[model samples]
Target: MSVRLRTALLPLLFLAPTLSPAEAQSGTRPQDVIITYYNALGHKNYAAAYALWDRQGQNSGKSYAAFKNGFAQTYATYVAITGPVRIEGAAGSLYATVPVKVTAQLKNGQQQSFCGNYVVRKNNTGGSAASQVWRIDRATLR
Candidate 1:
């Protein structure tokens, strides 16, 4: 798999529960955005996951078909978002970086861990309400 895809899918193995209204309005909560993305992936909803990323993040400039195929090869059966997602920069900043770790339980019972940071930027699309959204602009794994 491509490194970028691996990086993206590593964190995509997990799912998070519903968010509270406060979190929805925080705009600075990149974790909630990551949780929502992985939650879509957990349900095999590739389209939804793809939609969560910024234009550049989608397929890393490759076709969506390639992106979907990448996740198909992951073999992840379960995942959990572990630790706190650290936010860098002040609130209302144009961009924020979030540190994340995900533990993926493979179908073969082997567990693997991936650590990464998701760089998300505040979406400036449309009017005020839409501009409040944040999208993953990049995913880097280590």
Candidate 2:
């Protein structure tokens, strides 16, 4: 499976519960936007990756440099995910619950598999140029 598809799917899975006010307007189809953003990240498209972030910076923030570093590090830390993703959506956004297995190849190579969730939004929200960027609103490991 493509990395983008993998990345996008994870958020959709955890997007259950209810919609938030942040996402007022949504794209006709959000899955496409999610997948595209991840695809861009895999290709080393920093700008494209940034586009995937809301850029509002709840905890992440508006600085491109900070966002880039955070984005790259997270991707680098988790090699990949395994299994089908569960998804949820509200208003104009979606979340994915991704099953992940991570083993620090350097420290001990101990393999572990667990589900992690990510929330994302489609641009169109008016804020700083970066706020319109798509991004992982929050990620939780279950």
Candidate 3:
């Protein structure tokens, strides 16, 4: 292969193992939703991350402006799925509890860590195509 072609393809090879945040949002698995959320946050795509919440951010318990401002001091974030996701079904909806450990680096050079579970839900009954995918219902982190 030509040097230019090989160089161009090198980056693609490195990215093959991970999907972009947009692509990840289409994933059917609960864990994928959580991963996509964090990925968006890490990329500073607050709108995409906020939309991952149930009811399109209404269930996030914060206004859109507040949600984005909340990360003003955040430089970057990393999340680790700490345990196996627990899934259950109730009233035609599927819920998944995902354990995670998150570390955030602030713009001031401070780091904050949190560990907890996030409840993700998917509607199995009638709804728009967007609603059928898993979404973050709530979170308990400390």
For lDDT, the strongest prediction is: 3
lDDT of each: 0.62, 0.45, 0.80
TM-score of each: 0.65, 0.40, 0.83
Among the numbered candidates, top TM-score falls to 3
Candidate 1 lDDT, 18-136, residue by residue in tens: 54333533545666777766666667777767766776345355567877787764455333455566555454546666677766545444567778777777743445765567777
Model 2 Cα lDDT, one tens digit per residue, 31-98 = 33444444454445666555455544443356778766654333323324455555666564445454
In model 1, state the lDDT of residue 89.
48
Which ten contiguous residues of candidate 1 have the minimum total lDDT?
18-27
Global local distance difference test of model 2 = 0.45
- Rank by TM-score, highest first: 3, 1, 2
Higher TM-score: candidate 1 or 3? Answer: 3
Pairwise lDDT winner, candidates 2 and 3: 3
Q: Residues 33-126, candidate 3, lDDT per residue (tens digit)? A: 7777877787788999999899989989999999999999886677778999999999999999999988776776667899999999988898
